[model samples]
Target: MSSKSEERREHTCISCGINISGTSAAKFDCPECGTLIYRCSKCRKQSNLYECPDCGFTGP
Candidate 1:
C-alpha cells in the first residue's frame, strides 16, 4: 500500500469555495470555468461535484 503522504491529494473547489484535501489522484475539471475540482472526501454524498447538467454554471 502507498504511504499516507502519497495517498493524500490536494485540490480546491470552485463553486463551493472550499479547500479540499485528501482527494483522489484522478480529478475533474469544471465544464464552465474549467476549474479543477479534486475528488473531496469531505463532500457529503457527493464526489467531484459538477456544474448543472443543462447549464455550465459554477456558482449559484
Candidate 2:
C-alpha cells in the first residue's frame, strides 16, 4: 500500500512545468534512463517535447 505522503505527492509536467496533480497528465518512464516523466494533457495533445532529467534524452 502507498503511504499518505506518496499518495499526496504532486508531479510536474516535464513539458510545461505545471502541476499535474489533478489533471489528465501522461505518465511514463523515460526510454533512455527509466526515469518517470509527466506531461500535461495539453502538452501531450500538442506533442510537446520533454527531456529526461536523468539521461537528458528528449522525446515528443
> What would the per-residue lDDT of candidate 1 be over residues 1-60, giving only the tens digit for each residue?
868776564556543546666444336655676655453444434543546434566432
lDDT of 1: 0.51
TM-scores for all predictions: 0.32, 0.91
Flag regions of model 1 displaced more than 4 Å: 1-9, 13-22, 44-56
TM-score, prediction 1: 0.32
Q: Count the backbone clashes (under 3 Å) in each candidate.
A: 0, 0
Candidate 2 yields a Cα-based lDDT of 0.92
Top model by lDDT, which number? Answer: 2
Model 2 Cα RMSD, Å? 1.1
Residue pairs in steric clash, candidate 2? none
User: Which whole-number lDDT from 0 to 100 does residue 22 have in model 2?
Assistant: 85
Q: State the lDDT of candidate 2 residue by residue for 1-60, as single tens digits.
A: 989998689999999999999888888999988998989999999998998999999999
